[model samples]
Target: MSSIKSPRQIAESLTELWSPRVVAEVDDAYIKVAKVQGSLAWHSHEGEDELFFILKGRLRIEMDDGAVELGEGEMFVVPKGVRHNPVAESECQLMLIERKTTQHTGNVVTEKTRSLSDQLRPV
Candidate 1:
């Protein structure tokens, strides 16, 4: 049987910035946690929507349409095909819900990008 998981605890245990670790799964989506600072590339998933829930610090998601700021306990969802960049002025911990096939950086690959195999690593 599967055990219960603590998203915040798992997120806090991560040592790598911008690298996400899978925490759980629900149907077609994977629940993940990440420790981030600075910025992730501007990109969009052609077929998957990405949801972000703040667990610790602040984050600003910049998009062509506008930008949204999220604080601890807040959340946001970036629709599929919408280009967005997630930035954090200081270290922030967050939970992410995304389709299993969602690309880490969408269509843009950079040094910070992590493949599905990498994200699937044990937390």
Candidate 2:
């Protein structure tokens, strides 16, 4: 049976910033939701690209090349091995799609990092 999930509801239920909750899965990729604010550490995923879909507010993905701004209902894909950081001037809701093995913080682990196990818990 397929379970119906609401990314917005899950994102809103999140009590921790930058902590993503797994809401669904498609093959080897996991669909996750997160409530974000401020900035996340600069990092890169060497083996998998990350997909970010904006659900609410605005998001700016900063890279050495430049920064890409995304508004509600927009999406962006950060290629593998690219150094990037996600930033939101205000609280933003986001949905992410990435390989199951993708690290929460890529190569840079911070105090805000949450493990995959933690992300799998119920929202």
Candidate 3:
């Protein structure tokens, strides 16, 4: 099953804030999109690097040392073992690229956390 896919369009179809939906896979990585607002718990993936690509709106990734702000058409990568929290003052659409074995929310678990199975659900 292969076809043209729009990350933005798939991101727009997402309704659950912070719940990322898996859209595709490339080797050991999973490409996911999420519609989010507010903040996700501070966490770190010990063995995986996380990539965030903004599709719409703005995002600020708060880290222990500092924070980075990203707007539409921007992207950032949180290296493995760096604690960070993603915050969006308003609704935001973004895509994520992470290892298939990466845990959602990493070492921290919260109500907003979505498991791999949940993320794999169709949009």
Candidate 4:
């Protein structure tokens, strides 16, 4: 079993975008904390869904269909194989929930995909 997590505390420790720090994990899923700004690449998980919960600022999810804006205390789920890009106009803190094996950049394996093994840490 794992311990409880305090995302606020975990988020406080993060200082950059695309650099997520694991705050907790359950089974094959991981809860990560990140600070973000600017635009992220368009990508999609092959077989897993990803959830984004905004804790401190605004986040925008851009999809081929449309754009979804999330504010503090808001969240949205990006379903499997659905291409989307996340963007933030200002610094924001958020939690990302997805399978541990899920690629950070989904189908787009660019330099931006921070190696999952390198950024994960036990809560």
Candidate 5:
């Protein structure tokens, strides 16, 4: 059966900052949503590209080469092997599209890093 999922409602329902919950899956990728603020640790996916879609507020993706700022309804894709850090001065909501094998924090693990099991939970 098919169901409807609202990214806005799911994103707004999130209680933990930086913790993304798996909302849906599209073949090899998982579509996720999270409410975030502040800066997440720098990390890079070795073999997968990650996509970020800003749902609310603004986001600044700090890259080694340059930084990209995204406002509401904007989206960006961070290519594989590119080191990047996501930052939001204020609370922000976003949708993330990543391969099932893509690690949440990539090679670097911090206190904020969330596991696949953790992400595959109900919001």
Candidate 6:
């Protein structure tokens, strides 16, 4: 059986970096934490929507239709198959939630799309 993990524990295990670290999983979805700076690649998940919550600093999401800016405590959802890019001029802490099988960078497959394999804990 999987053991329960608290948010504090997950935070402690995560290292501050531009890439995301899988922190928790619940059924089909996984929670990923990341410290982002600069721009993320443009891409879209073919089969799942993605949710991003800004824990600290600011984030800007650019899409083909428009752009949305999120501040600390703000959240947004990118619908499945919609092309989007995330940017942070300064360091930003964020929580990403999506299907467990979802790729971090969709089909882009760039070096920046590295995954935090097996890091997710059940809580």
lDDT of each: 0.96, 0.95, 0.96, 0.86, 0.97, 0.80
Per-residue accuracy of model 6 over 68-95 as CA lDDT, tens digit each = 9999889999999999999999878888
Per-residue alpha-carbon lDDT of candidate 5 for residues 28-123, written as tens digits (9 for 90 to 100): 999999999999999999999999999999999999999999999999999999999999999999999999999999999999999999999877
Question: Which candidate ranks first by TM-score, i.e. highest?
Answer: 5
Poorest stretch of ten by lDDT in candidate 5: 1-10
Q: Which residue pairs in candidate 3 have backbone atoms (N, alpha carbon, C) closer than 3 angstroms, thus clashing?
A: none
Where is model 4 more than 4 Å wrong at Cα?
A: 1-4, 121-123
Kindly list the per-residue Cα lDDT of model 3 for residues 12-105, writing each as its tens digit.
9877899999999999999999999999999999999999999999999999999999999999999999999999999999999999999999
Best by lDDT: 5
Clashes of 6: 0
**What lDDT score goes with residue 2 in model 2?**
96
TM-scores for all predictions = 0.98, 0.97, 0.98, 0.91, 0.99, 0.84
- lDDT tens readout by residue for model 2, 1-123: 997888988898888999999999999999999999999999999999999999999999998899999999999999999999999999999999999999999999998888999999987
True-vs-predicted CA distance for residue 113, candidate 4, Å: 1.3
Question: Which residue runs does candidate 3 get wrong by more than 4 Å?
Answer: none
Off by over 4 Å in 2: none
The candidate 4 region of ten consecutive residues with least summed lDDT is: 114-123
Candidate achieving higher lDDT, 3 or 6? 3
Higher-ranked by lDDT: 2 or 6:
2
Better of 4 and 6 by TM-score: 4
In model 6, the worst 10-residue window by lDDT is 114-123
1-123, model 4: which lDDT tens digit per residue?
556668977886776676888877778898888888888799999899999999899999999999999999999999999999999999889999989888888879776678887677443
Candidate order, TM-score descending: 5, 3, 1, 2, 4, 6
